[model samples]
Target: MTSTQETTRPRDIGGSPGHWRRMRMWATAHAVDDFYQGLVPAAVPYFVLERHFGYVEASGLALAATLGGALPQVPIGLLADRHRLRWMSPLGISLAGIGAGLSGLVPAYPLVFALLLTAGVGIAMFHPPAGRDARRAAGGSATAMSYFAAGGSVGFFVGPALATPALDTLGIGATALFIPPAVLMGLVLLRHHDRTPGATAEKVRRHGTDQPGRFAALTSVEIVRSTISTGVNTFISLYWIRHLGAGSGLGGTALTLELGGGVLGTLLGGRLADRIGMVRTVQLGNAAMLPALWLMLACDDKYAALPLALLVGLISNIPFAVLIKLGQDYLPSRPGTAAGVTLGLAMSAGGLFMPLLGVVAGHYGPRGALTVLATVPVIAILLSTALREPVHEPEPPRATPSTTHDRHR
Candidate 1:
């Protein structure tokens, strides 16, 4: 090809040219999309207060949101893998925000359920394709992927902070305020997504070997960890309110410390993964969980629980990004499918067990519910020991001027 002709063709969707910039774009979109998810739980209290939803009814809302997102993800991931649909990211993120943001405006229980379901579907839509793209940009760097994961952590932290005041002063109708960020971020992602690159056919083929045993084990580990984490998130505030006689402000403060610890844990896990390898990092997180849980339980003082909450959050979340990356590596031929299970099914499936925990809490109290969480990490630690890191060839060097045209062809 002539020099000008070669220059005119867009760069192939392979290799790590401007990788960091591309990852940041995907991460920013991730943060925006997940912010809506974080809003659902935070809005539960308002629903009970304003809409007069009973415990069962309010829990149903959370269930609807979870089912909507979790059920559709596998099919969406399959479709994304087959089509590599570039438009999914923008459309998914926007739909997610709109559906979630509209929840407060609806009066009837049925309408609120429908809106939150749509939001969940939108969240599911964004994850598979966005994860695929982010992996391409990250070039197998667990640390970089952690930074991307950290964006979601930050968004979850920000969601309640933004939503509480709006709902407090303006009432449920103020949910409309959340819509603009979704629109803005969707437009921003739409502008750059097509320009972003994806994995080459060769790279995908090289690591295409499937390991079903390892995948199943990894998934089981996630289920255990997710179950424990979700239980803590659901009951930790109540623990403070009931056991410690803490006021509303202190309850919120406890949750904040937990989430803030997650942010720190994510960053730390990624760095450790890169240094000690993925399996060991997973092991480290699992091992730490028991002690953290013990510390939180032993502390009776509200002020003492605050710091333990941070420790528990860090231990629980440290393996998150590493697990996602490991799942992808294990099923390289089916990264989208892997993302569907790891990010969608495995994580949200844990929430399904909450009703059972509620049963436990009812009979034994929230402290008993939390006490059950302590044993889950032991299962995870044993499972982590069995995980073997998937192997692949080293990344090839980027094509230089002397070989650019040849490699492009």
Candidate 2:
């Protein structure tokens, strides 16, 4: 078929009846995949408590998962771009669940680390193909992509919430209970792919030139945003307790509020991006973060700062889904790679900077650590200045029948 014909083929349109159904499927799959990632941190304390692991050993398990998830995504994405990998999503999630679930069943520290690492790889394998397909299913709608992003956020929250109680009641082995969701979700996704004709053969044919430079700039902005998020989430509670003189319960409440605000912000960002354009939406989010964070830090009363904490989370995360969508737009030919770097690598890279922030916190307190974090948005704003809206090249003109006949002759 001609390029024009291919371009105009019937496909899922954004906001259509079937669009939401497909989006929900992808989002739910994403949640299942990321849940195992969330389980690692939730299960870490149990490892220490039950296994009598040292702090360093417990940290190693987290590191194992982090390394496994982060390091392989780009390569996996490249593979996804080159071939149809419909099975990756379901298989990846199942591996994630199996690795995490089995970790608690074993007694050896190395076994736990290996299992977590295996789960991390599973998470890695899931993102590229799933993200690529999800973007296609989203029909280039940023608002739709937000639903997908929000799924991962919700998964992270649910993982800890459900696992904590199970661990508390049944000891560490309760992690086995979390396995069913992954298996069940995997089966659902697998069935969906199998039943949908041509689903495995669908490809994103590129029309525009790939903008690696713009994608890189966007990645930088995301990295900065990720760093800021990590810093705030890591230190906000401590800042509340130590600096604002709030009790421990109030400090935890502050963290919860921040996280809840993030979910809202992700959804809001998608809608805003659709209305105002992704670049402007991202710039606005970064610009707004400056004042929101400064006000939160300046507040003396913990109670008053609680709302500010929510505002900070909201503003900081408003660009979250926007960046993801923009990255795919910038590199249309390699949506899988864009998703891998933006969704996985940037986040992991951002967390790697925490030791520096931790040192700052150690010497100057959580306030000092957060004070350093407050300046991070400026970097994102600067990087965003280099980004331009991706322009999709128009499809080539249709060939005349006479021309086709002549060419064949």
Candidate 3:
């Protein structure tokens, strides 16, 4: 592997129409998988309204989902690395959908929490294997990975856009309506996996020496970024409705715009990383976040704040896909583990702080919670300083047939 290998076209994976088709399928499945994750936050405000839950209680739901999603990922990653787990993709998505769909159907808070937790576990199960396959399909191209990452961003965007109207109309029970996409997408993925030759036993061989120090630093940066992202996602609607005196519709609109910007930002970051280098892209994104947060905080007018929300989201996520790809670069032998931590644990770990932010929101309102969030980017910027470009030693020429067969055996 070399820099050229990292930046080149997907020719390594044969660059066939079939390869790209697989990439598209995985990306679509990513969107469907993540939609449930996004739905938790979208439905949180309604949970507050209908159940009359306190801020801390509302945040607890987030914590349930976060904890379930974050804790088991590393082991799952290890399993994905050692075996072909094509079944996990569809099974995980179906579980995710089932859990999220049932969450709002019940009246008890404990049951709601448990359902969301189940949904989170499904999310945990989906990422490692899905990410491993997506990376293989991408042929190590950051831009290609961004397309996959952008799928999650799109899912997050669509969650609020669709959930808001439905919740507004049918109330919370509308969450049940979201179940079908996940099931249908899961079936599609299952059918594809079964039809594709060698899909179940394709091996991902170990490569290059691992760089734990750099990967640790990268994970730290991502943890901070995730905290900020989760805080905003969990609170932005409430911020608009309570502090800015906006209606629920506008509050939901603000969230939708922010997540929509995230979709664009993920795509832009991928392209930018291909040109400027991943570390620089990470630093640049973190640096841009300061002013974006400040401007968003300063806006007194709700409508005017909407664009700033978009800017905030765009700047905040510019490093997201880059971080995920760079993590795999840093630990080349463990792409599954890299994706697990970056895509699952580090990403969801931020939700662990939601209860604390809820306390802040309870004390001084959503603005105060957001004000606390403004400090996170500075920390992310400092952490980005510790990241270095990973060196990829060139791979040996193709092995002989007997060598390949023996290795496979």
Candidate 4:
């Protein structure tokens, strides 16, 4: 490429402190999307009975909260690729907050569901752009996305914890109280929206123009793996609770432990992939899951279940960061779309298969259902056919300490 071409290409520069800060900011803006939806599964049934609404309507409300937030991810992702995502993140949060804040204010059924659907739209809009930015902000590493993804897990945990208390303190009618903090953050985002030197903007713009073919290639396989992973998680929760005689509290504990494991696994896995290679890290994580499968299937003790579940979660999520990073490497031009589709759509598509899982569960019982999900990692091991090591040559062999000029960068 010529000098003009080198200057024109948008190279990734996400490893710097400035980029991590941006990732954190995007994380906070998108937290609102996680908070309420996570709260919905617990609240939706209550909304039906307490309000004397029909079960179908309440279930519809629940589905809207979930799939609505996930369904439109790709379209929004593509748009954010072309524009600054600053306002989009905040606006989506504010809209969801408005819907959630007003959720308890109304007495009518139609309006309540309508507002939730609206809330769902906001979440859908918010995630793709913000997630894409996280992929970019991660500065081309799996560890970066780990930090970014952990924020959502934390937000989800907070949602139910906060909502349960808020219900008692403010009552459902006063849920609007939750909106203030989010709104204030949106305002702050507007004020702090990046207005850096044109050179920095020029660099980011150039990075956005990298190879699209690579991104789509990784995205295709990631979509399949992600879908399988989501199915596994959703079923595990249901099977353990219903058939294993685990209580709601235990189920929550299991899920949280799994999430915490995922956070750690992602961090370690990404760094390992960086040191070794993506395929190695991916294979190691998936293969490590085999023992966790034994524990999950055989262990009946509640305490035993928790730690095993945690290990399972770790193995499940370890591959995630690598997939997101690879997607960006493949499709240099649309990192956000790459991350959003796999994380959002592939995940949702996975959950969408729960009905089939339910059928299998009915035939073999809950234990059998969980076994089905545990089997999916085996498929992931097989589907990893497309994976290849990143093209960057391994760092050269080190010389003697006295002779080597060890510059870390």
| TM agreement with the true structure for every prediction | 0.90, 0.91, 0.88, 0.81
Residue-level lDDT for 141 in candidate 3: 63
Could you arrange the candidates by lDDT from highest to lowest? 2, 3, 1, 4
Candidate 4: tens digits of C-alpha lDDT, residues 89-157? 777777777777787788888888888877777777777666655654554555556566666656666
RMSD of each: 5.2, 3.7, 3.7, 7.9
Please list the residue runs of candidate 4 whose C-alpha ends up more than 4 Å from where it truly belongs after superposition: 1-22, 168-171, 195-217, 220-229, 232-238, 390-409
Query: Model 1 scores what on Cα lDDT?
Result: 0.82
Show how many residue pairs clash in every candidate, following the order shown.
0, 0, 1, 7
lDDT of each: 0.82, 0.84, 0.83, 0.65
| Residues 160-195, model 2: lDDT tens digits | 778888999999999999888898898999998787
Please give, for residues 342-404, the per-residue lDDT of candidate 1 as tens digits: 888899989978889999999988889999998789999999888997876444454567686
Local accuracy of candidate 3 as per-residue lDDT tens digits, 1-409: 5322333233232123543454688778888988888788789889999988889889899888878788878998889888777798798899899998999899999999999999989888889878877776676667778878888878867776678789999988999999998889989988987876443223333667789999999999988999999899879989999989999889978987888889989988887887778889899999999899889999999999999999988889899988988988887777778899999999977877887998999999999999999987899999999999877676555557798789879
Best by lDDT: 2
In model 3, which runs have C-alpha deviations exceeding 4 angstroms? 1-22, 44-59, 106-111, 195-205
Residue-pair clash count for candidate 2: 0
Global CA lDDT of candidate 4, please?
0.65
